[model samples]
Target: MSARWAADLALGVRLALGGGGARTAWARLALTATGVGLGVVVLLSASSLPHMLAARADRSAARLPVAEAAGGVDPVFAAGRDDEFRGRGLQGYLVQPTGPHPPAAPGVDRLPGPGEAVLSPALAALLQSPEGALLRPRFSQRVIGTIGDTGLTGPNELYFYVGAADVAGQPMAQPVRGFGGEPARRGLDPLEVLLVVLGATTCLVPVFVFVVASTRLAAAARDRRLAAVRLVGADRAQVRRIAAGEALLGAFAGLVAGAGLFLLVRVLVPRITVSAFRGGIFAADVVPDWRLGGPVLLALPVLACAAAVFALRKVVIEPLGVVRRGTRVRRKLWWRLLPLAAGGALVIGRLGTEDARDPFVIAGVVLILVAVPVVLPWLVERVAGLLGGGSPAWLLAVRRLQLDSATAARLVSGIAVVLAGSIALQGVYARAEGDRPPPGNVRVLATAFATGVDGARAFTTALHALPGLAGVPVTTHALLQNAAGEKFSLAVQTCAELAVAGCRDGDVYTSDRLAPGAGLWSGGADRTRPPQWTIPVAGHHVTAQEGAALIVTPGALSTAPGLALSVNATIPAAGPDVVEQVRNLIGWHGRVSSLGTERDDTSALITRVLSVGSVLVLLFAAGSLLIAAWEQLRERRSTLAALMANGVGRGVLARSLQWQLAIPVAVAAVVAVLAGLGLDWLLLTLLVHRPMVADPVAIGILTATAAAAVLLVTAVTLPALWRTASLAHLREE
Candidate 1:
């Protein structure tokens, strides 16, 4: 606010904008701005995700049939006949109106009439494809119309509504007055909450680390510049204000750039994710959560200013000059480990409960993950000091690291955090994917209720007509009770139908001779009634059925007049497509599923979220490392140039650069892997209470990513190294 402070701030801003003797200032500023910008894009997108998913959920819930509404003045009978073709699942329903003027479902102008079907655009396309040959039998009804976007959660949904004379085929059919129901919202269970928390933390923490690192770029050069200002009679406070201004300039630019990038992503993402590869959302859904977005807007500049000013705290910038401290004192280790230790204590204290989602446990997990970066500096410093090699390139890198390893640590701290967090999250995801019920032996089944002998016969004939079961061995079964109240299940077929079980036409079977007056009931166990006929009094039983209970021929049960029974037809092969084809046969009366679809969807969701975050994290980390490499070059310009002038080959300098970053990052990667698995194991043993399952694939992927980042930094900086080491630039400061 004061004139002096204002003057000093303006001076620092000009210096950062490259007005002073700093030749590499423009590159440094770009690195900071770019770092902040990338972080902003990810943060903004993460904030918008909840709102986007909620919108998708609302659309999905809008079309659900509400059976409770069936009793309203106007009603329609509805049954779900959802099916799958190939590996792609589809939504479908069979409906018939009980009254005139029945309400239409969402996305359709009119309710379908008997013998017609309304299809979604994607389904219509599929039906026209050559692959539809296998699916055409299931939707034999005439195509009268198509469902619109209003009825679908995403553009590529396969959905249909077929008109039927009656909804008797489905077990869940009931009259529904109309279709809208409340959104099917469910709160995240504890494991889900844990995942969300970890997901958010992993994404944002690295950004903050990046911001802090970016603001402190070219620390040695900044210190020297401040010393010159001190020599010119500017006091400590004014010098500090100048540094803060320079940092703020980059942060401000980043904030603006980030806002622009976020908007661009909103427009581009929907267009790119247009199909089933990943579900696409409407542009309207990409609105940020102010709760998270607001802080990112407010904090970046503060972090920049604070990191710049704080780095100056230990350096005494006197009028004469200051010796830029690299390793005057040994790095401390105990305090660095304190957060991890304390957080672990808190988690262990709360073990065996809601610890997965418990705030204390979450806090502990954060500390442990964050500790990867904190402990990294100490680890790198110690390891770099002990490292030795005969190779000239390796010697050059190690000697320099032995002088100032903290720089090496900062170079990959963001990388370590991102990788460690990713591994822990992946472990939990693998566990969730595996925790499913086993599949059953029956691949396809069809069932329906029948009211009379005639109804039973019709249902039986319909079972025989079920599409996709041609030439497949089929058995029709029913559960029945006797007049004496004993219950048993029966499988009946013509002897021709029993050929699969080694029976011929004219084969006959009999049951144990019952007490006088005891006979089979026409109804099932759920509906016991009087005998349809008395037990036979004959002393002889038929031998053509081998005296078995198998109803190899219908004549076995025909003697009991009026044998009405419900029906179920089973084909018994649990191979691929068997369930879908069989389930289509039974239609709405029963469900055919392996329950694996939901698990696949969940896995896809995890992949989509984490895969994007991992990429962003990689880009952020790699870019930051590249900047650090450039900063090192600028700081050592005098040394590197003099070495080149003395005939040190460019190859040696390049290999040294590689060794400098790779050494520390390699050590950090191992530390990261241990810390990540340790965190994952703790969560699993205590919170998830599942077996400890480590994902080697996750570990390998993240480790390779970190290595790639290190390699990228070295490769990109080598070109800059040659430029910095030119003969014309060889001058001692």
Candidate 2:
């Protein structure tokens, strides 16, 4: 290489290394790099799961079309009556005329004669048939061509085909209206949404943290160089370029490493699921979408450099007549720091105010993390002061903390922030989920109901006559079609009885549509059509059991031929006798369930998960704390020797160290409390239905753990500190 080219390369390497010296700076860089790498791995892996899920859903969905009726049959009923039809023995079907359909019985003309059915792939799986195969749990038909791939229905459902006779089996006998209504649509995939949020958080948050940590490290080093340069007659602009260049180089290298790791992770994720494929011939290979990979790769390095450049902007400018003895806080430039503090506060506020239901809440929280460093310095100073006293070792540690408050704040703040932020979020989630209204008391939903007005009236009267069941409202519902060709069901009960099912009901109950009472009115065109009315069902019914269809009045479905009218009861939490008494009156065939059981099961699962996650996080924190603490301990050898010479006891010295550390953690607890409250507000206002009830026990455990760690670290260090102190006395010989 030419001399000039070699010099340029040398300069680039020097810039990248900054003034921390290549070897030492490299170690810090490596740690930061590791964090970045881990973040990328999590981002690439977890984020990619959703795409895989969607693809799986699509592949599964491919065999099924949106459940629909033949052109000759009313599509309106087909679309609106999926739940009703499914319950009445209609199965899921794929969209293809060539597919097999369910066989008809000897007298059932509406059933497919030989080989036709309409069913989703899920149904097919249950029946052990290929897509578009006829379901003959009772009979048989020849398997025909399968349904063509379409991205309309949910995965792995049964799909069948049938001619005009298919609609005849429907209990409803209303004359078929023209084919028109809401198309069968898939709801947003919760898994996909989770993946997207996880991906975005992993990618963006890690990168942000990596850049912030790296930038802070880089800028600190550069400032030392800049200070030296100012003494040597370098101009501000010249100093700034050198600092900027160094930062840019470090960032570029980190980004390159990060991207390489990111790509490797992306390639490896398909393999995680590959093990599950188990001898399948269809190889599950995802062509890495460069559409995604390319942008991430290109943007990461650029982002790294930009982050470095931004961080260094302040330290590059030299203050006039500034000395390096004390921390430099240029009075003239104090206003600049306000922006940083303000920026952090704004981010925190935004996250706090966000609708927790939105996935963006994750992003906001990650962004708010930047505020950690801004707040950490003040905390460290207070904490370090609390650990005072001069047994040589203790004095040394204190002096060190006092001397480089900036660096201490920068390094330790990340750890503190990780600890605090995690605690705050988890604390809030635990509280909110735990304190949520009991499923029975909060929702007042009926778990089981009988069909038909007569059944509902009799059921209501029977239950009301029983002692202790007077308040129980048996919500009645009807299924019907509107003039618009829309199908609906009503959940009807007296307004006072709405809470009996765990929901608030107006005099006219309707579906939960936001439009003012549209939930109440139904089935009519302009002035000519007859008004269709349906009652609304709420509480446990809406929250849990109303999965397939809306709760409605018995009169609604009565108009449909062969339709069964049922009254469903929202049972509250009570003794077995109370439950059985109601059940005896309704008969054995009535619908029966308790939403509280479902809620309790769900809550138990969440508790287990949170407990597991907290353990893992604590382990990570403890390990990191030990390593960092040990490193600090090693650096205090000279001070320890001095303290030992003065005859300071090892026990006292250990207590001092413990005291200092405890101060910061105590501060962190306060921060956690504030953050927890903020989180509770966010959850109550934006995410959940009730005020959060933080588990005092869980919080106590966490507090105890943190306290125990402080004491344990102190206890553990005493032997070592004593050994070192004793060695110092031996050195005196």
What tens digits encode model 2's per-residue C-alpha lDDT throughout 490-565?
A: 4555435435543443333334432222322233222243343333222223323243245433333343323344
Poorest lDDT segment (10 consecutive residues) of candidate 2: 79-88
Candidate No. with top TM-score: 1
lDDT of each: 0.73, 0.45
Cα lDDT tens digits, model 1, 1-733, are 6988888888888888864455567777777787788777777888888887777778777788786654434677788765566656677788887666777688988778788889887788878998676577667889888887778776666788888885643345777777778864455655666677677778877888888888888777778788888998989899999999888888988888888988988777656533343435667778999897888778889889999998887788988888666448887899999988987887787876764667888788888877888899889988887877769999999998888787889888988988888888888777766675554555555555554334556655655565555554434555456655666545566755555455654344445543433566643322345566444443223333432343434544556545545565555554565555555555544445444234445446655676677677778778777776787787788889888988899999899888888888898899888887888877777766777778777689779978987887788788889988987676644
lDDT of 1: 0.73
Q: After superposition, how far is residue 406 of candidate 2 from its true place, in Å?
A: 2.9
The TM-score of predicted model 2 comes to 0.49
Q: Which predicted model would earn the best lDDT?
A: 1
